[model samples]
Target: MLKKIFKQTIQINQIPKYFLASPKPNFPIDKIRNFNIIAHIDHGKSTLADRILEMTGTIVKGEQYLDKLQVEKERGITVKAQTAAMTYEYKGEKYLLNLIDTPGHVDFHYEVSRSMRSCSGSLLLVDACQGIQAQTLSNYEKAKDNGLKIIPVINKIDMPAAHPEEVAENMQLQFDVEKEDIHFISAKTGVGVDGVLRAVVEKLDPPKADINKPFKGFLIDSWFIKDQGVVMLVQVKDGCIAKGEQIMSCAFKKRYDIFEVGILNPEMTPQNSLTAGQVGYIFTNMKAVSDARVGDTFHKPDEEVEPEQGFQEARPMVFAGLYPDDPEDYMQLEKSIYKLALTDPAVHIYKESSAALGNGFRCGFLGLLHMDVFKQRLDDEYNLDCFLTTPSVPYRAKLRNSQKILEVENALMAPDDGLVEHYEEPLAEATILCPKEYVSAVMNLADERRGEQKEINIVDEKRFKLKYTFPLSEIITDFFDKLKSATQGYASLDYYHSGFREAKIKKLVILLMGEPVDSLSFMVHERRAHDFGKNICKKLKEKLPGQQFTVAIQAKLGSKIIAREEIPALRKNVTAKCYGGDYSRKKKLLERQKEGKKNMRSIGRVQIGKDTFVDILKN
Candidate 1:
């Protein structure tokens, strides 16, 4: 049976060139090279990708071609990992090179690792002026763990501050590569780019595949379009996939017919079919975006092929409640979120409600930056106004008089303080890189956040790297911003989950007129609870409008109130209405007014506006 399939594949490859409707990829398996560009944020990965496309004649020298998302363009950062296929000729031999340009921000590290699974080699980029950064080391470790061929490249050599030799020496010492092995290039000016391209074709090993085997591939990404349904980006591993082929997703246990198959030659260009070792997109009749799961394995319906080692499922490290600005737009907001989820499967979404804020979805993300980008996309792509709550990390607590443990992702879900056992907060191991001049300041900042020193290493004469263990909650808050400020924007941070630790954790709830406002509640460490409560109470006092009766704003933990503030009532002059009346009549009227206010205070509800919640939560 395998022999028969091999003969048929050969026959298909032998078909006359003119007989095909579109140009088919006929390169031999040995001539194909699959690789990705990995680096830290602002290291010129996109600029390098542009130069590669121009050199291969796949695209003209123009705007950054791979960063197609509006948020990416506006923020000058790559959010999604983009793919491009190019035909490069060297020494009169044609080669097929598929390049996956991955994002460098720590929030999108999943994209970097996922792209690594589909390729065998990576160009680890570092800005010559910046040298090794926090994410550069992180990505290098990922590449090493995946057993990928790493070709170190120093970018931005054209800059006056670039220190190519110095950077290469550090890379050699850190990555254990020879001094001559590092390639220096100015991706912006296209200098020394040809050498890097040559290295890709010669140094990287071709993928091991057998076209005769059953069709098998992994769905790395998927998104929705207006005219079409879910468009899936697949990395074919073992066999060939063509239009009309029936494929089954192991995750869904359902089969669907392929409507179209093509390669991303920087665009959705349809072709005859995609064979083993090719990265391409496929269109199917399946309309439900939820069905298009990333990291799913697809194979021929009739064949029994073991699933390949797929991508690691993305775990959300921070969660926030997202509510539409207008209550009437709940359904529209739900639809919009689903659409975004199709593109970013890392987001965790579930319907949730709040007493202060109406209907909303509690969404989880990889980090603060990930949550910010998701929110920005909601506004830019869907043109929808949204209100986001304070982001928090998931916490673990033990139930009272029971061994059962509870995981609380939102403050409202936290168990009562009488729980028999103690609480544990998520821990993270952070890698910080900074100039030696600011080492003292960075260490002080980290120490203030309850960080424990793990190790420290000197990268060069002027720079050093530090590893510290911190509560995940701290890292998700303003830690990054504070780090940048302390180091004068010279420090970079990357972190990973490092289990959990026992801590004095409590649920801090906000109360208005003695009524708990669920939306304003959050979990905090006992040590920081007092400060957190006081700050929030002050904010509420400034934001809440004065009511007819005095409104008391209090932050309470368990049965104790930690902070309190009052919004003064709007004083109305009943005497003004009684103008020129007798003094006894005016006194009687004042007493009546006071009595009504006291009664109203007993029964009246505090009128909290949407704007007030938005203001407090955002801060």
Candidate 2:
């Protein structure tokens, strides 16, 4: 009878006192602050977040989480956005601190932005010594537009050449914010963490919500554990929410019987009714997670209307053509993509038919890093082994006579010579901010990759802004790697698609022996046709096995195969002493290798081994 009474006492909407500190009848929501820690990759966002979490006493002292998952800790970057509930006692009243930690990489920009929508303020972390980079400014602008009050925090204060003053100065000169507004802290050493915590509680106060009415909560994130069933991490905005009842996800209006409503101390604990300015988890009967999305809302059983535009569908900005390395794994590949889509809805895939590669699909993303993460997720999470073709931007073209609109990703899909009257390729307005001594080096590097100088502004004698128009196709290629190399990693660059422009580009196919190797084909500008073919052939030559007969490689324009090379034949008489066995056995082993080489289809005299395509498309 006592056990039954205790179990029944914790209602569906009941939240524990720890998760949501119960307010008196007159308490207001203005004492709360909801914000996120954001920045470019390796800008100390995660370390700083740890400091805040430690300082606020949400987690114990000297108990660093390393983040919530293995992947996040191993990569040293935030893979997803996570919200933690913390309380700060300052000036007598306890202020609630709800902090969201986000990924700094550009690939997860949508996730970062979506998380930002829930935050009323953002702590913009920047590396003190490295100064500001491209992604830093981009996320900063996004947080600003989301109505998030900006608190610039110059991280890594303990570094040898720490430049808190320089980064502050750069923030003032570049982004047009007051230098005095930013905060400097070493989340690593827990330096100045108190100031950060106090500032968050004092300066960035919360938005108002009426708690006297019925409950309305926002589901910031939801997941399914193998053994635990379905779980939701939610933020209660108004009134009170209870467990043991049915609730609906505002994004889909899908209902679930609330099994339990609780707090997460790295684990969920049953609690009572959750009220305004609170964060907690809810276990529900809905298992598939088809109804919920990040940034979704949860409401009382009766509310009908959803958010105006529906849940904003995240669209991938970068697209890459993908193929199963071994055609037999097609079913495996399909299942892998579908499973990954469960957690990451942004990875979009569509069926594609290519003349060279045949049946395949095009995967879309926000950027190259986004594409890399998706592909890596397939390999790491889903265990799908596949080969990727060289990535290229979708090109827009029209037929000369019929004027048919065509979007081309694979070079082989590009129409014949006379068919294309005009083609427009995507262009990016790129910005490179760097020191004056490296400005010439950056400019030369940009020029080498076919960038047109748009403008150049001298910020100071030592700092300058170099603007350029670059092809999106170039960006997906090795352009970024080259920029990093040329600038000695000093130049900070950022580029966004401006629009499409007329392009003088053509498809260049690499032929092994006399037949084309489909995956090696790429779109190359008129002047770069030879260079593109040469680079691919050079990499392929190193990867392909040696053959009995001379193997030739050539650059082809469809039916016309031009520019050729040959891998010289194997020696008729190899050294007998090299092998332990007799000459005949050594000859047989060599003969087997030669047979394997012959079995592979050759473009002319060039033979491509089975492993020729691995990491060929990667940097």
Candidate 3:
């Protein structure tokens, strides 16, 4: 009788609902130092992130907490963005520093902008010797367009030839940054890193959130933490939350709780409290990771705040049909893409039925960099076989004859040429920084690609800079390849979209065995199609092995195939190289050639590589 009474009494004790939602944004602007770190590739954005973590005592000294990816450190390039939080105490006041490190490569602008939206300031890093390349200016422009305050940082200043003062002057003059604000530091040596930290403490104000109300925060980034499920790194903008409280992200319509909440120290500190201006992690109890997408907003259930803007579903800029190289691995590839999409929502894949490629969804991306990264990620993360179309960035136009706007990725996808009245091509305005001697070669190469010389500015007696405007279509495929070759990798170019204009553009498709191979297609001005065709034919002919019949290779534009080359059959009684049971090797080579002909594209008696059919455009 006593046990029954006790159990009934315990059950009678009522359980209350756990509350997790965002309150109003009474966040005072003064306390929020919303900023991001932006730089060119190899300019040390991730390394700097590590230094800040160390200086702020966020992680233990000598611990390698940043760039946890082996490939990232091995390749010496940051393929993705990294976010971390730190606290700087000065003048008897503690300040929270929210750091969002962004990719410097051209491909990651979408994610970069998403993260940039959460900040009001940006740190622009310029290589002292490399000066400002295209990506540096592009990222700066992204932040500038978002109306963020910029602190120009001249990184790699420890190098003997680093010209930090000149870089500062160039920034002040070239980009109009304040002279006093350029910070010169070597993130590797930790030199001047403290100065940057002090500047952050001195310059930026921490975020002031409405702590009196329910919890609302910004979802900066998200990734799966293995056995822990999904971990969301967020900034509580205007609210508070306790452990076991459930939260909802208005954008993704996801509800999760504070499974564990705290700053991501070297090892996270489980905290009972987090306030506005705090940078920390919010782990959810959900087993499904897809719900915790990055760049979404989180709030308590009933307490509402102003809806964050730019959460609109991102329209993919480039679309390509994806397929597994090995058809047997198609299912494995499909599963891998889902896992990739969970991390990078921008690299999207949806089901589509194509007449040619069959049932495969068109994959979408932000740019060539995004496409390449997606392809690489699938290969690396899932170890699956996959292939994607050549990267293309869509453009908009209405015919001069008819003002109906047409949005397509390039000349290939644009409406027929006759319908294209006043169609505009994307142009990249570039500044090439290099030693004075390479200026002519760089300028010449640009000209060869139909680039218009905008201006030539002298950087110094030993160095010079040239500005050029080229269609984005031209640069997307091979501009970097050519520029790097001509300059021997010494020249660095910076690019920015210079708007669209009426320009001559054409897509050249190279045909082997009368069938177009996707690999050989490229965008070129109509004027250079003939020479480009010849160069391509030459390159292909050099690569192809000897065969029994003539091989015809040509470049086609729509229905017109131009400049066909026919390779004659290898003549003469072929001498067999035979030594130590290898005597029939040459005869066997002939037999293999004849067998390959059976597999090559005939196009009514012409022969081409069976393997080369789809790979012609890759070069």
Candidate 4:
């Protein structure tokens, strides 16, 4: 009887009547502030978000808040943009605040862009000690581009190295932000976070959306949930959407009946309707995952609205092959990739097969870190063992005979020399902001990577911004790491895609035992082809284990072998039994061993193990 009563009590507590039913609160549009927090990585973006949630009582003092993703917790950085709706009472008046905490890494700039579009204002947080960095300028520009009001805040003011006044001056000089408008606070200690929150309510203009118009919302982010179909986080720009309403996507031209409409109190809370100027989520009972896109527009079936402008489809800049370690798990890996792609629309993937690696997906990402994050999520979320090939950037090749151009993301897709003319590699305009002390080192590093200086602007006596245009292929691999190292972690870099430029690019192929491996081939600049071939050959020679017969590794440009290395066969002690015998006997034993080795080499085939492939790719 006691156990039954206890179980009943627990069940009752779990099912709140208010939570089960939809909430019907009508918030004035003029009183709602839809904004996001923007900052450089490790400049306390997440910490400040936590404080905002705490101050608004959206979450309790000790409750675990944003940075909810497991990978985010481990990395101590925000990977995805998370939304939370909070109601703050100031001077006896209640105001609804919709906050989006976005990732600071340059790789997730797309996420920042989408978040910026959904908001009317932003809190531009800067570190007091570190001052303004590269991403600070990049994110600020994005917010400004979206016409969002920016509130400058100096974070980490409690630290011993805190220089709030200096950072404020830098902001004033670099961004032309008025010094009087800047706020100084330590996000960790909640010193002045409340003031920042109140300022958000006072300074930023309320969302200017027409609630009387037809229901139309911008799908800022979306993902699939098990048993729930597709859920989209949308910012209502006009009118309202409610649970059980019929909605259609303007981009996909698909219709669905909404299963639920709710606000993210960090967790989805059922709401009767999300009115204009409010940000919330809608669950469509549609199983087709492709119907929902990040930047697509959704509206009621009876009311059609023009799709929002400035919403471009996310394009993948880096390409690689993702294969499972175990070939039998190919289908599982494919399913995992599909599921992950549903959540991350920026990641483009299609089926691919390799002779050595079996079936996999040809995956494309925004950048190197984006690729790594996708791979890491695959391992951590889906529990699949995956192997990734070397990353490459997309190139546009013009055909000589037909004058037709083809965009080739994979080297394997490139046409042979007989059909190809010249290749145009993608170029990106990169901006590096760093201290003056490390400018020379950064310049030298950029020069080594074939970067052409475009311009240089002095920020102040202590810092400056360097602009350069580089082949995306050159910096896609290790350029960021080198830049950080050269600047002693003080440099921050941002880049955007520029148009393609003609280049002397050649396909560098790696041949194992005389057979060319298509998976091992990559495109390289003609000037560095020899050095790239030599380096890869050396790395492969070290990675490939000794086989029964000598394995010859060669790097080739067309039919010409540019670099060659050999892995010696594992030798047995064939002459060990002749230790007590004469020198002639030992020579005879060695001769017999050599003859056997030669026989083995005649028909031997070198087998490249999975570890060898991983090592080569990692190097």
Candidate 5:
């Protein structure tokens, strides 16, 4: 029966023999460790995971199996959190290690937070050379808040510039750990990694569980598969979940039969049952994309259990429009986005139509990196090309008559200036870690972006941490890139929404041929409205195709035009046929052509191609 089910689910050429025959091991709760590795980007979390997998005989040594997505391979970053189960014999006893490898980028903080919930401990990896970064600190705080036992592991100790001693000292101050508590290892070369593994077995507490209670679990993550509906990675908190069992989601309130229960030993290996303290995947009869909530709790249909405290839904911070280059691909793109959103729930998608770009979906993401990665995944995984518009943040508008507040995520959704009492923009508190030498540059960059310094602390003799609060709109666009540029790529930033503040902001509208383009309109501060209008008008003048008549590009604030530019009409010499004709005949031909151009300008509609928007949006 297992073989038959495997045959139905497997899309590959052939199913692996071991998947069909591998015996399930029922390890005791005390012998199991549920933990995750958390660190900043490029801090060697995946490398350390690979080493751990190899040492435990889960897979080959050089296989970077943690990051399975194509975008991850191309970008060399983990965009999603992945899990692996390993069997290791420590001393004379065997232990079951369930490890979740989390992304370090701040854009995926939701992923990190969700992964942390299923684990009882975390390996806080830090780079020896780069010291502590802003994300590292942020992740550390999350781990602390989750009540996870954190092990300070300093990686890349073998590098030429590596200062394990200094990094350890900084960790001591930041994390309040003793000298002996810190573990130094080079993840690349595998030096002292074995000791780190031993530390995991010894220091980290096993997950607290009781198999005698009713079956209960919460989904840590989930993804859709072609042949097999939705596969969920769940952490069983009590009792057990088995194949052919009827389970119901506490959140969705829908029942599903467990088609298969398995653990990813880096690969899907079927297990008879997943008990308390075990992290494994469940195959269900869920076909709808919305059926599998990422953090929903599940329980036996016959039992009444209190629902677990599931994760708070991720809120999108940045918004952008994603329209297919060809309108026919809209349905396909919509399907692809729904499928992708299963794995990434933070992206908020809604139907939006643009006057400039036509039919598309306006999507919201956590940050710029999240938006870029989502688009790249669409291209790489789904073979879909999308025309993306300028990213904007959600703004608040107040109606003057009723004093009702409106959330304006898309520029088209924003009300006219007269309809508002005032506008309030979202603010974010940014935490930056940088070398002291670049402090002045960082400060200047922050000041230029209307940031107010909140606090500055010296991390060490040569490094300091700067905290600033700025309008979320300011940092959502190229602020991190500019920060890196000013700090010579040595600065790391992490931020969180800091509520909304009133500001002198106005809606900047772009009109083409006397018609407003929804995609080109945006909200800007009153102080920078003129310059932004001028720049946008200039950019449109260059990218917009010339029409039969002169095309007027104008940026308007309320009733006043702040900036204007014009594109010359594509003209043809109507009088070319008469080389030696009378001057009056030539003059009459010119006047007729001019009248035709004028009539065309008044009646004709300009069509902006996908390439034009792409060029204008490119940085």
Candidate 6:
């Protein structure tokens, strides 16, 4: 039954002939070098890639082709993993180089992992000024685990404070790489970049795969294009795949007739077939976005081969409710989210409805930046205005009566206190790198976030690495910003899921004028509930406008109030018309005014404007 559905394909004649060019002359697989560039954020990975592209003439000068996303350009960071295939003549022989530029931010670690899986080696770039950082170590470990050869390179050698020799020694001591293998280059000035590229051709081993074997490739990344349908980036592991060939996904067990095969020369260039040890793209003419999943293996339909191992599913660390700014745009928002999810399978979305927010999706992300990028994409690509609730982490709750466990992604989905037997919150192991001078500030900040010190290692006299275990919930909100501010933007952080631990947690609920507001509620540690409640109530008090009747704002844990604040009512001149009347008439007017105030207190509904919600979230 599934085979029939998987057999669907678009007619081959519909695609342009330019997108299905003739097969190239067979080249020895030994001449191909598939590698990726990895480093800590702001360590010049993208800059190095630009230089490589220029030196090889794959992209013309003054062309911005790799960092195509607007967000990446605006922030000067690489968020997406992009591939560029270049042909360079080295040592009097033509060699094919497949270079994948990966994201450095921890939020996009999954993207880096995928890029690593497709490569035979990696260029481990480090900033000469900053030395080794948290992500540099993290990415090194990832490369090592993949059994890929790592070539350490020191970047920014032209800077005034450049310390290439010192950084090379540190890399040798920390990573155990020989000093002779370290390459120093200035990507900004194109100095020594030629040596780095030459080293790649000489040092990195060519991809070892048999061309005679049945066709098998791993899908490293996938996204949807308007007319192209689902375009998948694939790394050929064994044999060859050609246009119009029948292929099947080992993970989804779905079949597809390849509509097009191409290579990214910083732009999509058509190719008839991709043999073993090659990296390129394949269009399956798949209409559904969910059909092409990252990390899935594709092979010939007749041959049944085991899928590649080491594919880790992306787990969302932060969850939040996303609603349309206008209630009437619910359907439009849903469609937009679906479209966005097609491109970003890391984002988990499900239908959710709220009394205050109307229809929305409970979306999950890798971290705060991941959520922000997803929201930004929705606005930029779909032109949809969205309202995002405060981000929260997933918590495990046990029902008191049935002992049934529930995964609570949103605070609103949490079971009532009476129904919950106990709760366990997720914890993470964080590794922080900072200069020795700011060690005290980083430690103090970690302690304030309820982080427990596990170990501290002095990398050198000037820098150190500290390991701490923290509640994932605590660090998901404003912790990264605080860490940066505390260290003057010199600290770097990398973390992974540790496990779940029992926590003394309480649901902090906010009530406005005797009515509970679900949007303002949160789950906080019991010890910090009072402080959090007080802070939130104070913020709300300052944001809410004065009304005719006094507005009571209270934060409660179950039935007990932890903090309370009141917004004073606006004063009205109700007795001014009685200037010429007797004292008895004035007294009557005062009585009427007092009676109206009493009635208003009981019936007035506190209206929370959109701007007020935005302000509260920003605070």
Report RMSD (Å) for each prediction in the order shown.
Answer: 7.6, 10.0, 12.8, 7.7, 7.5, 8.8
TM-score of each: 0.89, 0.76, 0.73, 0.88, 0.88, 0.89
Tens digit of per-residue lDDT, candidate 4, span 407-518: 8888888889667789999999898998999999999998888999999999878888999999998788889889989988888888877789999887889988888887
Total clashes in model 5, counting residue pairs 3 or more apart in sequence or in different chains: 0
Lowest-sum lDDT 10-residue window in model 5: 10-19
Worst 10 residues of 2 by lDDT: 10-19
lDDT for 173 (candidate 4): 84
lDDT by residue (tens digit), candidate 3, 1-619: 2233233321201212222122112234354455678887888888788777766656544534566655566556666656665556667765556677776766566567777767767888888866876577678777888777777788887688887777777788767878767777777766666667667656654554667767778777677766777777777777677688888878666667677887655345567756766667777786665676566678887767665666544456566767666557767777777777776666667765433333444677766666776777677777776667556655665666675887654344556656666446677787777777888888888877778988888765556778888777677777887888888887776665667876555667878777776545565567877887888787778767766656777888656777877777665454534444665777787787677656653534534453443354331
Query: What lDDT score goes with residue 449 in model 6?
Result: 92
The lDDT per prediction is 0.86, 0.70, 0.67, 0.83, 0.85, 0.85
Q: Candidate 2 overall Cα lDDT vs. reference? A: 0.70
Can you list the residue pairs that collide in candidate 4? Answer: none
Please, what are the lDDT tens digits per residue for candidate 5 over residues 9-73?
Answer: 31222212222223245779999998999999989998889877766667764558798888787
Candidate 6 lDDT over 439-547, as tens digits, reads 9999999989999999999888789999999999889879989999999998999987778998987788999987889888788898889999999899999988899
Report lDDT (Cα) of residue 83, candidate 1: 93
Alpha carbon deviation, residue 43, candidate 5 (Å): 0.8
Total clashes in model 6, counting residue pairs 3 or more apart in sequence or in different chains: 0
Candidate 1: tens digits of C-alpha lDDT, residues 1-619: 2233233322212223321122247557788899999998999999999888777777766789999988899898999989988888889988889999999998888888888988889999999998999999999999999999999999987788987888888998899998667877778766777778899999999987778888898887888777678899998888899998889988888889999999888888898789988889999987876787777889988997887664677788898989988899999999999888877778999999877678999999998888999999999989998878888899889776788988889888887777637888999989999999999999999888999999999998989999999999887878999999999999999988878888989889999899988878889998889999999999988887788889999999878999999988898988887768579999998999899999999999977887888888862
- Candidate 4 wrong stretches, greater than 4 Å: 1-24, 512-514, 543-552, 566-607
**Model 1 reaches what TM-score against the true structure?**
0.89
Off by over 4 Å in 1: 1-26, 401-403, 545-551, 567-605
